[model samples]
Target: MSRLYGDPIEVWTREGRPVQFVWRDRLHAVRRVVDHWVVSREWWKTSDSDPGERRFWRVEADPGSRIGTYELRFDTAGEGWLLMRAWD
Candidate 1:
């Protein structure tokens, strides 16, 4: 399948609770609580620094899908979201 500009990473939830992560219209990986963490830091020094918290997830997609394997970061400011990092 062709990758869309904004490749969708579906955050799956059950009973209104987050359960796992899906990538590119496929089952990518499950979200383990131990694999998730929270970080709070001051970005005031940077031009876009804001007071907020960030949630990080370690996701594993298909066995050999480079683009499929990625880390997603969710921030509180602007309620923004990002694909913080990825690897093959």
Candidate 2:
């Protein structure tokens, strides 16, 4: 599970998989994908506002000497990429 903040970000993906991303003005390279999941349409949302099939990836990020795990999601509409949450 993740708490999404909807914070916009710049992501670089290769072969449809995220390799790195820039968040909070810092660049972090994703070392591994710990988990993966997909979210279907929100039940509460109206048909006009439905965002199709969101892809969520729980990934380990390495930023220089420190490392952290973050949750990222790719939206098919509206926002392209977002950093949902980060674990300390």
Candidate achieving the largest lDDT? 2
Lowest lDDT block of 10, candidate 2: 43-52
lDDT of 2 by residue, 3-47 (tens): 557688899999988999998889999999999898876655535
| Candidate 2, position 71, lDDT | 90
Q: For candidate 1, list the clashing residue pairs, or say none.
A: none
Q: How well is each residue in 1-88 modelled by candidate 1, as lDDT tens digits?
A: 3222334455654663345555445555443333568787566632455667777765555523333445666666645455565555
In order, candidate lDDTs are 0.54, 0.84
Residue pairs in clash, model 2: none
lDDT measured at residue 68 in model 1 versus the true structure, 0 to 100: 47
- Model 2: residues with Cα > 4 Å off, grouped in runs: 1-4, 43-51
* lDDT of candidate model 1 versus the reference: 0.54
Candidate 2 TM-score to native: 0.81
